[model samples]
Target: MVAVGAMGVAPAAEPNTQVPAGSRHYAASDFPDRIVASPAQDAATGFAVAWRTSTLSAPPLLELALAGDSPDMGRLRQITANSRILQSENGTSQHHRADIDGLQPDTLYAYRVQGQGTWSAWNHFRTAGAAGQPLTLLYFGDTQNKNLSHVSRVIRQGWQTAPDARLALFAGDLVSGGDGMDDSEWGEWFAAGGWLLPGMAVAPAAGNHEYFEEFEDTPQERRVLGGHWPVSFALPGNGAVATANTTYWFDYQGVRVAVLDGTSALDLGTAQAQAQWLDGVLADNQQPWSIVVVHQPLYPLRAERDTSVLATQIRPVLQRHHVDLVLQGHDHTYGRRADDNAALPQYISSVAGPKQYRLSPQARATMEPVAEDTQLFQVLHIDGKQLRYEARTATGRLYDAFQISRDGKGRKQFTELREGRIAPRDCPRPVSPKGRDDRCWE
Candidate 1:
């Protein structure tokens, strides 16, 4: 049995593996379901692609083409030859994914996926505007542990708050068990966010949870996890942990969004042994705004306070890069910490699910009741030189708002929202409050 720790396992010949030449097969026409866009194909071009397949043999041979304005298939622009691959897992039926490349920047492109007997209705996505253009992105935190109940709230409320986010970044923890062996959780996550998926790109970071799940007790765990990962979403091959498909970099108009997988940092060390790789990547920057995201938060909230190792090891690299913004999860609550070099980095953490956590007083003005307990999420809008950030509650109410402008040039300056509504006192405390026991179950 392989140890269920970090998922850095090397592929080897296994006698017991049940990989058939082509086992489960689904006609795309029968179950025309999920179609996702990921892994920007070109780091320098406006080309991006997504994949879709049936539930059987599930995914189809990827057939791509340059889409025209008209939804009419015959009235299209260009169509590439059929490109396809099959990724099977745990026996739960799912189609693998593919990405389209060599696209025109700032243009709308339509695409569709096909399988055994089904073909998805054509969906459209607008390529990111050229660099320096104002843009919007939706940021979400750990949908870990439970999804059926908690995740639905986050996704629904997020859709309510900002339905037009060009992209949605799930800062890791897509599933628990440290892995995708938990087929139920994975299915629940996809089910919960099914509404907005076809229109939005789910850029995921592999959290520690993606590495967990039952190996033998459940058939889902027996053959899924890693196989499903690559097939699920087509991400940019810019990240170094492995290929551009795994840990990669991308550009969104004026800002350059860099995504790293911290869960793979300590384990996939040699993959990034090439010196100056990150430096060259960041130094060769041309965008006005730069933001980086990963699974572990550089600035953890109250419920999570153990980052001595991560801080000591990765902190220096972040500082040297002068990276503009960093998005993360795993702490489970919303927090903002700034002031790098002195002690902790200026960062903000938020909980996206209803299964919440209590906050502490490691930082002043951050004790429970002083912060927030409501399911949280954030929407960032970059317009010209002014960048605006808004934090909202589950009911679509504003919690915090700030607009940062170009004054420091390299340093960030904040301008408080004079009219934005901010909430107060709705969270748990470090020391249990009266009447309620320190632990639940009373």
Candidate 2:
């Protein structure tokens, strides 16, 4: 398991031996779980799907077809996928990925994956059209849950807020630990997303917990990314070497989403390359709106944490390219920067799990509408020159709302400050005699 340091906030240790609670049955005739879809680098032309099966050495097969009246089921096109075997304590499973291309723009296609003896239910996903279309997307913070079902509510609420979301971006730490040791956590995480993942594109970053064990000749505290990060989610491979799957960029409609691997860049020896790649991607970005998704925040809210290295190296690129939004996680708290720095993109860091951290005095003083002991999710809508952002709690209560738009003279402006948001809550501090109890969710 990877170590998680909570800056100045003391986070209670989760039970190390605890296994995920819930269903773990997978028969040879059963369909796959942990199924996820990723938008192709050019979403208008293609998309990809990845799934897992408990049957080892399973053949890679996917069937896809355009959904229409009187569709010919016998004519469905079958595509062979690339497969690899992953071993875990739960058992051995095969992860398969298939990238479907030569697709028409703005078309709806139905596809399904197959196991050794059973086929998954057919699911449909819509492709993006040519540039210049409105887009709505969901953003989730660190969902490193002690109990996967706890965060599952927030995920469901997020979809309720924006049912038309084309993609869901996770700012890393999808699971608490067990990067490879425990496969049950991944199952639980996938169970939390359920069928929603198959319909929408998923873009995620690699957090500290995504890495397990220590690097060669390094201290145990220093870890490398887990084997599953790349295979489980076959992201765009246009990122830096060795971090290709974890760090990549994709475009949908008129928005460009660049996912950066903060764990590899900061701890591993890939910061410089990632910095350069970020600049290149942003420099070539032609989208009306540009968004950067990273695990760690540039201006961290935690008192003892200072991501100056990321701020100094990457923030300049975002500012120089006029990136519109910077979505991030890992602080386990909800807050937005209050500084009046127009040059930098708007920063938002939120949490979607049960873990809670007390906001530092400085964070409470400088950040606006901060929330502790709360699980939050953000919804972003982009239409032409206007971008709307809203942060809501797990129960669908509005916590913060704002909009950014471009003026006639090509100047960026903030307008339409929706009010009546409930004030932030600071949950009672640690109280259990053992000091390991979780009261935030209670």
Candidate 3:
């Protein structure tokens, strides 16, 4: 078996001789794997978790307890999981989910999932605190390509940087296979995250790659949300009726984070509905800070790409609501731009994977301190009236820094903190078809 270590790095060894020669770390065994923790709509009192296991005769379940020094086995509460069978290219497996509630705010809890006769190692997570508390979070862009080999280090580095982070927000394109038919990719993604995934709440935005093209090579070609999405995550189902789990909003601490299904909004004729729902979600926001997470950017950093739909449909709502920050991915490069109009939300597009794209000419003019051929993750801290942001490279080098403070009247003040930051990394020429050019400098 190809064993993934606690650090999430796959060993350099041949495949197990017992299974198929090509079978590696992706195959599911009787043991539960791909365990992930997510926040509830109101994160303080509840949370959700999901995992995958080989087909079993009986259903799976989850056990939880308030974390304490003692084993506390007698106090454990058992919650039956809702299971669904998913057939993919890797074969058939069952996905299990349990929405755990009645939790205490700002408390630590230990939980584990049970398969037929075995149980996963107990993982611990802290629930979000009550309102008016400070918050720390990690933001990541696409971990699509080379997830196991390359992106693993970046994610691990982020964890090392902010081990106490309450949430990890993924912008989108978590995998290259849009359909989730390639189950191995998802396995690699989970393996790359390893134990850190269970320790913090995950909020993922659906990217174009998370959907598969149906009826290809025909006039009726359309995109369909992958089956793995709903099964892999038990997100807050507070989005538009048509866009249930993919587009939802949740509040953690003093911040309200709204994740949008840009792929669905752009392809499935749900843009208007999402826009309207987002308007209401933000308009009713009582949190001190509001952030929006989406796959596509309102301002495209890729030369050949266009985001007219997002610009027209979603950008206005964010501006009108005075969102503090907008995090996005899909350009495969790092670009941050604070609009000249202070009322506009600060826009940032970043990549955490190995894929690299050339920045457009307009990107140089619009985006300051742009980067290419670099993998990065962001650590953000939000207090009462100020938000401090830092972008660090895969090697933990500081790349860009900024701070945003809001006045009592909700007026935002942007402060640039990149005075002595690392020099911008880019390629003089366009990237090769293979995604990188030899002349690239990081």
Candidate 4:
């Protein structure tokens, strides 16, 4: 284990061991629940927010104002939100969304949502600052299983590491059940992030688990975006027409994050469309840094998992655009591959839930610092021409560190910071079907 002081990492905090409450505890009510603030296409001057409620008798409303030392009711501006009714296993509910725009850059604002006649407490968020300004972001992999019980603490620790992160990016598989029928899973996911979900702008890519298809309906497996997705997030609806909000991009400061729906692209035969869309988005990107977040990795880290189709379609577009990094999830393990060719983007696949998987032979041979049975979160800070990235275990121990610096000619130099890092925790024995390996510890 690395020394906390030497690594400049805070000691691991006590894990939250309390069992999550029942689904009824998180059921929709007259008051707003599952409120989330998301990034707009141009996050510097605009943002979007969404929430769920039990009833829709009255139109949903949102109030926003610049945050101040004291709350002044008179300064609040009222905006009516658009609502959509959704039927799920839990029950019928209404999801409301409002896109707030015309705001000052790098400004802080307080906002709240309305449910029927009730109102949610005030939550605040800051817009993106000017380009070239320092930026920090928190990235997480799948929180698919045991979300509240095991993944909650990891999410909290990420917030602790970068409390002022401009965005919290999830590679995906946010819940175990992809159909959106299991509202309890969504509840656990929301509870895992707690207040942090609404405090920072969230950008998530849709994983395989976020899509569901009925075999009886089609001879070929055709996945459909779950009902809960659009209702749960008010993302920038500017992607391939078929994927729309599920596949989008947003610019925060100097970074352009292009989120893709790899599940839909691979299973639903939308790969060509998304590839073309990605090429255009990247071609038009003006940010100094470019990142692609997708649930399925171009390089699969798990044994026997096939990603050749996904890789073939998307990899060329990414390379052509010179994307700096590609963050992925779904293998339920941690594996990173820095290509020998610096022109290729750095590829990383990680997991944040209790679930685990065995590494592929290729991963064991080519990827460095691979791990299993360990939940991790990443904190990335970009200042000027350099980007510093650190991967930390759920216990807050620094596991891997690296820095990427770009030159005036747009060439990148990768530097590994291995001092004070803990040894990789790969399982000696293969992980069991239930994600168990006697030698691997949580």
Model 1 TM-score, 2 decimals: 0.76
Which of the numbered candidates is closest to the native, going by highest lDDT?
3
For every model shown, what is its TM-score relative to the native structure? 0.76, 0.89, 0.92, 0.91
Q: Count of backbone clashes for each model?
A: 54, 0, 0, 0
Assess candidate 2 and give its lDDT.
Answer: 0.79
Q: In terms of TM-score, how similar is model 3 to the real structure?
A: 0.92
| Candidate 2 local lDDT, 306-356, one digit each (tens) | 787788788878888888788999888888873346734778899998776
What tens digits encode model 4's per-residue C-alpha lDDT throughout 215-254? Answer: 7466775666777887899999999998886899989999
**lDDT at residue 253 of model 1 (Cα atoms):** 64
Name the weakest run of 10 consecutive residues (lDDT summed) in model 4.
12-21
State residue 184's C-alpha deviation in candidate 2, in Å: 0.5
Per-residue CA lDDT of model 1 for 388-437, tens digit only, reads 87777777788766677755464566666747676563454343223332
Sort the predicted structures by lDDT, highest score first: 3, 4, 2, 1
Decide which is better by lDDT, 2 or 4: 4
Question: Scored by Cα lDDT, where does model 1 land?
Answer: 0.58
